[model samples]
Target: MNELQHETSPYLLQHANNPIHWKAWNDTSLKAAKNENKLIIVSIGYSACHWCHVMEHESFEDETVARVMNANFISIKVDREERPDVDAVYMKAVQLMTKQGGWPLNVVCLPDGRPVWGGTYFKKDNWMDILGQLQNLYTTEPERMMEYAEKLHQGIQILGIVEKNHSEAKSNPNNIKPLVEKWSKSFDWEFGGYARAPKFMMPNNYLFLQRYGYQTQSKDLLEFVDLTLTRMAYGGLFDTVDGGFSRYSVDMRWHVPHFEKMLYDNGQLISLYSEAYKRTQNPLYKNVIEKTLTFVERELYNSDNAFYSALDADSLNEVGVLEEGAFYVWKKEQLQQLLKEDFEMFAALFNVNDFGYWEHDNYVLIQSQSAETIASQFGLTENELLDKKKNWEQLLFNEREKRPKPRLDDKSLTSWNAIMLKGYVDAYTALGHEHYLTVAKKNAQFITDKQWSTDGFLWHSYKNGKSTITGFLEDYAFVIEAFIALYQATLEESYLHQAKQLIDYCLEHFYDEEKQFFTFTSRDGEQLIAPHFETEDNVIPASNSVMANNLYVLGILFHNGYYEKTALQMLHHMIPNMDYASAYSNWLNLWLNQSDDNKELAVCGKNALENIRKIQAEYLPNIILAGSTKASELPFLQSRFDEQNLLFYICQNKNCLLPNTSLETTVAALKIS
Candidate 1:
């Protein structure tokens, strides 16, 4: 079992029985490496990574490779999700060393932990040869190794540097149009994502685009968004039989997914689809929101209501061997046998023959045409086609459930749980579902009760009723964002108060004064080779960007100038770096709010709750809602309450309009503004 047998992370425990002597990333293992003067081999991967599992079988499980690893180096295994700080530093080093980086990230570092060499997955022979070469170089040419490590360490230090921009470049809505125009050149007009293979569902990018399209009334951009959302939901990336999304599609058309279903992806995608549904009233988007939530609750949700990390891409096949996408993909004969008379229509609808064909005689269900298009060919209405799809889904789902399920990475992460919490809130807001709000509150309560600390801090990972790792900035950022959303949804003052308290903690511990940006790790947490300020918005939006957005919202709600200035300052710092629209999508979204004159809608009176519901039903991205059924202590809602009649005060930049009793008129003012 080596040293990882006692670790709580599922990824670490997966390696407990490996032939290689492995240790979890910690002070004890690191100190032992220094004591023995051995080179450190840091291998980072998550449990759901299919390539990580393949590498484990090909190299780490081999006796000869393990002997070499055991003899020349102290091997440290890191689950990237659990220890993102470690992964960030090493990943930066690898990307600098080579031109690319990926999972099962292997790096050889000097005893003091400066990375010297690294790569992604390798075959057993290549892995052994690389280790042998590194060991030989260390013994025979020590100075050369030291020089390389020093250079790499310096590069790592500069990777995430955010210099404050003193220029008074206006956070203009005009600037976004040119940037989107430049970014639009790369869009795959046919496939709905960027013109590239291995497409990711970058929710923030579309989120920003959705807002910009509606605000600017750009039909082209809005149509692009609709195309992208519809294609993604129709593609194999979305599990038709099950209900959630896989991590990403391996092809340009979103035809075949890499197959791992991650909590962060599903959570963010939910918020995206829900907002789209609100804007367009697309039945497809609503179906995606409901189905994905069902998947999360059924498969990933804990008894405590917090979500687990992910579902493994690889599961046991019929012959009892680990194969990627085994549980999700189906055989043509099996489908024909199961459906019988209905097989012909089902095959036509889902493209089961040539277009959906994957390797090994397996077919990944993919739709090239919409249900409306397919229904026309089959001489049926769209509703009829959808009804048939539902029945087919039920039958296929039951059969698939009989197969071995993919392994679950059962550890609950605070940042991801918060993301899912916001998903539920957005779902409830868009759909007006009371049960969604109830589930969101339950998860919010779970986070405060279990993951949060009385010392104005949070824990990063929780499992088996224990949380030992200090929370990173990502945890605090997403929780604050989610709490603020929850406050808007339920008008619960406690949630708002808790959000303010979290931001206070972040300001003290995670904020960097000189950079005017938040650090990825708290000041009191463990420091790595270099500090990282995650700025780029990937599948999950960057922590600093989310924090900046939260500051902007809370500042308006609580009337704090410092928070407002800090949010703008952070945005100004990012202006020079906004070369790629998708990467800086969250930052751009914040800029959108500022440029559009974001309003504070305060609903206070006898029908405040009822008015709040009507307001939420509209797709108004440029509003911070605050309400009270009667009187309230919040400065934004203070003295504006009257028990006699409903009132809506639309305020911008601390200036308020006269209280209007008409909900319809208020909504019209928001739309026109």
Candidate 2:
């Protein structure tokens, strides 16, 4: 086995026995690079990355390629999930240098850890050629090579400064309105999604639009979110045959997908859709949530109740061919053979054709016909047709299970769990599903018990009973957000207390007093070139933005003036970046629409608790709920509150009104705003 066998990350362990001598990304490896005066080759990827695995097999596992890498460079392996801060830093560099970046990120850096050149994957022979060229340049043109390194290092420094300096102009409220208008104008009205060819499941944007619609009562905004959610629910981006959403659509219509499923994306989007359902009372939204939860339970859930990261996009088919959509796609002949007399009906319903939906004659599972059309065509009632479709779905799921499943990235990450915890908690409230609450509580407990350190710090990821990577700001921020949500759902004091403790730790360790924003890592943690403060939205919301929203909500719930002040300060700090809100809409949303009236509904005492739960079961977006009770008594309200509550106060603007101990008064108070 290679030295990577000793590493904790499953991604690294996957390469344990490869011919490559892979060293974990650490000071030891960096020091070795410096000592040997060798160029450092850093390859960054996560476990469920299909291309990462392919690259590993093609290059890292090949003896000749390994020899070339070993002879020419000091190789270091990084699991992007384990060290997102590092990944973010280098990914920015790669994107700036090459105009694009992705995993398996292959970069060649100088001994001092400054990246000089990089790209994603390269063929074995091509890689050898590049290695020879780089080596020759370093040997013969040392000064030119040093100059190139200096330029790259300076470029990175400039990017850091730019990132640090981004903030919306707070001098004029008019500044943000234009940006909001710009985003609104960019909405794809006909399609119900954003204007783009390759569409992403951008829950953040949809969520922002939902909030915008509530604030402005714009029919366009509401329609955009509603149409997008419904279309996505009926499209290939959503696994109509299984459950849960794929990562993104490869086409403009959301009809074709890249096929990878990520837990964080599913978790966040499920909550968004559930909240939309609550607002619209749309059965389609509810159905989407149900199917998504089924996917999570069947595929992503681990034994510990913590969710896995993702499922690979690629799976081997029956013929042993590595096909992208093989598991999901169906051919005309195959459907006819399987369904017999029902084949035509099912084919028409699912859009199955001889030509198929994808390249290479593959077919993606889709809902081409409306429920009414399918019912009429099949000569059955809507309920009967739905039941038949459900039965067929089960058949497909069972059959797919028998085939090669996509490789699971089983590593448990604190940030991801925090995101999913909120998802489960929100879904529990929206659907009144007890099982969702159970999973959320178990995962929260797992994180608090296993990932928390004695020093009040949190680790990022865990695998095989070992947790090693130091937690980043996202881990602390998102987990705290999760705890706060769990507290709201269950009205348990402990979760709130724990969340407050985490907030304190973040303030002490990660907060930049001068900058008024949280740093990506603690000041005393491992030294990078600069302490990053991420404000842009990616697949998940930024740590800074999520934590800012978290703090704002906590302030409202607890009536803590200081927390609200801190939140405002953080938003104020990020105000200048609003010009680019289209790209960072998730972060910008927290600051764009100011809520002048935040109603707080506080239900205290035993009699009011049941009513409070009933109120919570209904979607209340702008209100915060808190119950003052012992943690032990939380279990009785677990089905209602779902195990995290006490000292309940639901308010806005940090000025909670008098606590209402009656359900009627609580409802009346909540309805006021």
By lDDT, the best candidate is 1
TM-score of 2: 0.91
Writing each residue's lDDT as its tens digit, candidate 1 over 233-303 gives 99699998878999999999899999999999998999999899989999999999999999999999888
Which runs of model 1 end up more than 4 angstroms from their true locations? none
On residues 1-673, what C-alpha lDDT tens digit does candidate 2 reach at each position? 7779888777888899988888988889899999999998889998767678788777888999888888878988999988897887788779878999988899888888888788988888888889889888877887787898788777776564323334544444345557778777767776677788778877887787676666556777788888888788886888887888888887777888878888899999888987897788887788888888888888888887778888878788889876566677776677677777877777777778642376666677677557778898768887888887788887777766777887678888889888888998888888888898898999998998889998889988887777778899999988988898898788677898798889888889988887788889888799775457787776688888888887877765555778777887777766666665655666556564355534555555554455556787665665656664333333212322323333344555534454334555556555523
Could you tell me the lDDT of residue 486 within candidate 1?
94
Q: Specify the poorest-scoring 10-residue window by lDDT in model 1.
A: 164-173
Point out the worst 10-residue segment of candidate 2 by lDDT. Answer: 635-644
Candidate 2 stretches with Cα past 4 Å from truth are 160-176, 354-356, 377-379, 629-673
